[model samples]
Target: MNNETTNSFIVQIEQKQLLLTALWPMRFEQVQQCKSWFAQSAVKAGTLAYGADRVELGLSFANESFTFCYEDYSESFWVTADSAGGAMLLSELAKEFSSLEIR
Candidate 1:
């Protein structure tokens, strides 16, 4: 995990007082790809929140929020959210990339 990028994302979430309700582990490349898909798919449904580094990305949909960050110990990226809808949307997006393991 890149401390600078991770901390930036954490600060944003804290400032928003968002609750993390779900987390999905994925590779760095996978996370990037997911970010692109999200930016395209949610363009009509929500707003995109992109940080300085490509790894720090998020989406706001309705009342839910989805964020991409790194899991330090796992040395991998994770997609976190504040609601089940976020998880559902991620699942739907992952369907387009069979290699992505949502669990």
Candidate 2:
């Protein structure tokens, strides 16, 4: 990761809107896999909506929460984390997927 990407991850203490990408565009199956990962993480109040070109995911964990929109065309994930815990959760997510880029 570049300095900008690394710094952004550290500088954003509270709410952050991040664009997550991989080497290739993500498919619907990949999105489903992500959802399953969240479920395994014990997220609360989770919801998932699938569309032809996108998938939306919302999850809450105690005081931390995040929402994600995966765009198939761009193979990117738009993520918003609203709290410190949420930010930490996002960090954990990035660790889980080594190919994920936080930008």
TM-score top scorer: 2
Q: Write the per-residue lDDT of candidate 1 for residues 7-89, one digit (tens) a residue.
A: 11221123223322223444555544444444334322233343334455555654567665544344444456557666555
Give the Cα-based TM-score of candidate 1 against the true structure.
0.34
lDDT of all predictions, in order shown?
A: 0.41, 0.57
Query: What lDDT score goes with residue 70 in model 2?
Result: 79
lDDT per residue (tens digit) for residues 1-103 in model 2: 2112331132122236556544444557767656665433445537788888888887675557778677877766666786766776765544433433322
TM-score of each prediction: 0.34, 0.56
Model 2: pairs clashing at backbone N, Cα or C within 3 Å: none
RMSD of each: 10.7, 6.2
Clashes of each: 0, 0
> Model 2 TM-score?
0.56
CA error at residue 92 for candidate 1, angstroms? 0.3
